[model samples]
Target: MGAECCNKDCLKPSVIGYGVVAWLSSGAALGVGIWMLVEKSTYSALLASLFYPVTIYILIAAGTFGFIFAVFGCAGAMTDSRCMLALFWITSFVVFAALGSTGFLALYYHDNVLRKDINIRQAINESETNGLKDVINMLQAEVSDKLTFCLLMLSFLS
Candidate 1:
């Protein structure tokens, strides 16, 4: 009985630690997904195809479900509830699958579609909406600033 209790005590801390890590990762995913959704105009306007929006939606869904599952994991670990732990594990697998698919789709697009389809110059020139134009200009200014900084660094090195 004493050995069994010690084993459970060790397991409980490990499970709770895993739950904490999951919580942090899920939060980061959720934050990025929401940021992407909020800035959809900037990204979607630049992209020629529907791939960006689809990936964003998938990311959002995965993050949402991941967060919920993380909560279940923490609760289950704290309470030592078998049912809650089972639910947490099941939901976590689904979230992991969603995230994995999103990653694969992103890699595929980066290799095959993004290079051929995305024309930043054309996107800026053809931008119909004022919002899109603003976003493009903002991005351009940021790039220019970074370039200027790089040039300054090169000059100092020389």
Candidate 2:
């Protein structure tokens, strides 16, 4: 509706922003998939899992997940399929809302269903990390103490 250009030579419809973002999403998906495959570690999974939902959102839009939504949007713009376009438009609005404001809140809220689940997950992840750190710390302290004792014994023996 708020198209910036209507020139016959303009290949892009309504907004250049959409095409740019579609490609950006495509690139990000490729990057994440590559990172997951190549890295293959626990920390990588943790980091990737943090953005899991966003990845799902991107998948819903287009690219490797299929161009269904985006194709629908494009077709709608071209007036070929109003219903599919309308559906994509609704989702697009939700997605933009989520990205712009508290569509994130609309999609997810800290006071609602996910809050408890997120809290539990975060707590568990943190505890695991802390437990690992504590084990490492204890091992370090024991090593230090043993080293100190060995030096003292060697001094006396000498």
Candidate 3:
């Protein structure tokens, strides 16, 4: 008589756990991206370039793909399927690269392109749309209030 033994996959649990975390984070990213695009859209008029909306669009795309990749990862882990795992790995890499590039480009545009090209005062003055003007005025008031608050805090501390 012989005793039978079955192989145990030790990494399956960790993979599924990672997939769950990734899925939640991706959903958050998607939500934030959509929210920014829809709610803060008026602020886009102040920008001289398309980078603002483009970055948000990229975030939305990456989040959507990340969600899909996480599903693949969870499915692969559960089924012990190599093909799904490979797809997950590849999609994850693509999403990572896209996010990294978007961050880099945003920083570069803020420092170089925005500073040189965008004049907030000019944008506000040239804005023909009432909504854009209202948004600009609102932002100016908010900034003024924040600056006043900061100054008061500093005076109190000193």
Best by lDDT: 1
Candidate 1, which segments miss by more than 4 Å at Cα? Answer: 1-6, 121-135, 142-158
Give per-residue CA lDDT, model 3, range 4-118, as digits (tens): 2223354788889988988887888788889878865566666556677788888899999999799999999899899999998888888888889888988777776656445
In the predicted model 1, the residue pairs found to clash are none
The parts of candidate 3 lying over 4 Å away from their true place are 1-9, 113-118, 121-133, 136-158
**Model 1, range 1-158, lDDT digits (tens) per residue?**
66876787789888888888877888888889899889776656565566777887888888888888888898999999999899888888888898999999888778557564445556657867666577677878999999999999999999
Q: Which predicted model would earn the best TM-score?
A: 1
In each prediction, how many residue pairs overlap at the backbone (N, C-alpha, C within less than 3 A)? 0, 0, 0
lDDT of each: 0.81, 0.52, 0.81
Q: What's the lDDT for residue 18 in model 3?
A: 86
Q: What's model 1's overall lDDT?
A: 0.81
In model 2, residue pairs whose N, Cα or C atoms come closer than 3 Å (at least 3 residues apart or on different chains), thus clashing, are: none
Ranking by lDDT: 1, 3, 2
RMSD of each: 5.9, 14.3, 7.6
In model 3, where is the ten-residue run with the lowest total lDDT? 1-10
Model 2 error, position 132 (Å): 11
